[model samples]
Target: MSLDYTSHSHRPEPDELVPSRYALRIGEIDVLVISDGVLPLPTAMLAHNVDPAVRAAWLNDMFLPPDAFDWALNVVVARSGGQTILIDAGLGLDPDLNLPRAGQLVRRLEAAGIDLGSVTDVVLTHMHMDHIGGLLVDGVKDRLRPDLRIHVAAAEVEFWASPDFSHVSMPPGFPDALRSAAKRFVKEYRSQLRTFEEEHEVAPGVVVRRTGGHTPGHSVVRLASGGDRLTFAGDLVFAVGFDHPDWYNGFEHDPEESAQVRVRLLRELAANGELLVATHLPFPSIGRVALDGDVFRWVPTFWDY
Candidate 1:
């Protein structure tokens, strides 16, 4: 069975410059953060509520361009007890959305030696196109188990049924694209949808709780084992959120509520000191929150090899 030859070329496939996955542990749970690549978005999307000059100033302070930048799409895989859970799927179409990059979840998962059928549960943070599009790709459904359980908040499913975009400031075509994607996803996966009202535990120490702000049924997953803990804050908190928690991201369905939720979560995380990872933070977004005088701060964890 050992048929490997040492002569294999070192060149990487699947764009293996960094190989796209990070692994860590919390007590008995095994967690993996996978990069689905990055999406290039307008700088305004970072904070639509702030004055243009203020937004530009913050970007300048961070040494970033005042135009557009690549926002990472992070996906997580966790193994607790015998269940293999997928936190969120990445965007699957690139050119279709005018996003020439991203949608690499499927390829990256295979590169990391994870078989699609092995995933026992899928916990969607919300049904946004970027978060659920990877599952709608052609032939992707075939690779999944027929009995697979997809856990999502009941409000999330209902919101997409009649989505309202009056509050969001997304780029043109995004709202339409999102609606189509959500409708198609529901049609294709209705049989496996496992809707939860407020919270659900997919595996030991892995609990997903609804936190309505980003989306009506938006949720976050928390893992606690022994004394270790981590929270996967899906789209609720962003990189810029630390410096300006009230500044509204363009994607939030309810910007006011989202800001409130952001402040609350940031305060909680700052107080608890548990590890934090977010869907839109940088790749392998393992970090902690800290209250830096007035605004919050993001303290990233050093990479372990």
Candidate 2:
């Protein structure tokens, strides 16, 4: 029998929902969750290392599409001690890439009443494209907040800016592009750049903790004030990683080390009741980690209208 493929008469036009933006109060600090956009990746690209059966089962159990993974690109704005700080720059204005739906960070920021010039600092959790892409305007000269102090992990800057980084095996031109971008960023914002080698306060109540593995200088940002704590976990764990902390995606520089960091950080967050703001979780990706038997589960923050 043939199936009916005609459009229904009463069907309404699809609504173009505005991007998500959320604000959270962490003690004395205020954090705004700005949505850059969503990135739809192949499920296999994320779970390539997992056994096919196990991967399929996991997707089935979660009621997720077996062939697709919808990942969120979230950037954070933290306001504390009279300082407005941006965590990671969203994908910048790159028209040639496949990320047409992405790179809405600047517009979203404006919608949220945040002026780029008013931003005092931009803390880079790592140097990945998605995390740092929003820094530049045309991929060459114009920068978003060039005068703002740009804080990055020393190790990250050293590795990505060095000749050794070109030797790292990556997609055809990934390394070269990354190197070029990093150099441009460095040169453009050199005067305002600050590199930290150890875990230290980048701003009042803001701490940068090195959690390498995903990249040479991957790190998480910790915000503390009035006994309340929230962590900006940059690419530390994605959706599937919550159930299987050891499952490594294709992007990690060192899968084993990345897994170790995930496991250790999950334990710490769960035990301490610290709030986690994952960059790649669903929109408004603020949550708490809860220990579930041998694994961990993500409990997203309750929405307050």
Best candidate, TM-score: 1
Return the number of clashes found in candidate 1: 0
Error of 1 at 121 (Å): 0.4
TM-score of each model, paired residue for residue: 0.95, 0.88
- TM-score for predicted model 2 compared with the true structure: 0.88
For model 2, the local distance difference test gives 0.77
Cα deviation at 3, candidate 2, in Å, is 52
Per-residue accuracy of model 2 over 212-274 as CA lDDT, tens digit each: 888878899999989999999988889888898888776677777888999999999999999
lDDT of 1 by residue, 106-219 (tens): 987776678899898999999999999999878999999899999999999999999999999999988999999999999999999999999998899999999999999999
What is every candidate's alpha-carbon RMSD to the true fold? 3.5, 8.5
Residue 50's lDDT in candidate 1: 79
Clashing pairs in 1: none
